[model samples]
Target: MNGPTILLVDEPTSALDHERGAAIIELITALTHERATATILVTHDRTHLTAADQIVEIHDGRLHLPAPAC
Candidate 1:
């Protein structure tokens, strides 16, 4: 509650190996939930998409947002 409300991470794990990348993702996820902070993760890595609650895809210079989860 004392930290910034929004967290922006760009290519945080780009230079990391699979295991290390996953660890970074896990740490971010934990912080996001624990702090109740909104997180925007910008990356081209599809492997980490599973950690997302919503997925946004940018293709052809357009943004595609997923349907609301029900």
Candidate 2:
């Protein structure tokens, strides 16, 4: 039962050491693209953030989009 899928991972890399964390993030990203699945990776690491196609930040219970440059 699979065509396209979605993965909602919360703090998925937080527990691992640096190398393992990076590896895990890479694995997740690879699987998402390879399987054509939509992945919502919830992480505080800015390094992993770049791997996302789009990013939504939340603060004080509010969602924030990137602000327009002046």
Candidate 3:
């Protein structure tokens, strides 16, 4: 691919508590943006998506892309 480097993270905070989980996602999102890395974070917790540029979700076996800009 000729796009920016993309990192795919699946459920990076499924096991941790709410606080720690938010921290982890925040860190990943911050680093990704600071380095211009295109990150694809697959998460179920919508609250932890503060750092994402756009949020995409899979619903009914399809991709939903109504996420707001960051």
TM-score of each: 0.89, 0.83, 0.78
Indicate the residue-level lDDT of 70 in model 2. Answer: 100
Best by TM-score: 1
List pairs with backbone clashes in candidate 3: none
lDDT of 3 by residue, 1-70 (tens): 5456888899999999999998898799787877787888888877777777777778999988895559
Q: How far off is model 2, as Cα RMSD?
A: 2.1
Using lDDT, give the best candidate's number.
1
Better of 2 and 3 by TM-score: 2
Residue 67's lDDT in candidate 2: 75
How does model 1 fare in lDDT? 0.94
Instruction: Give per-residue CA lDDT, model 1, range 1-70, as digits (tens).
Output: 4689999999999999999999999999999999999999999889999999888999999999888879
Per-residue C-alpha lDDT of model 2 across residues 1-70, encoded as one tens digit per residue: 4675888899988888889988998998999999989998888877778778888899998999987769
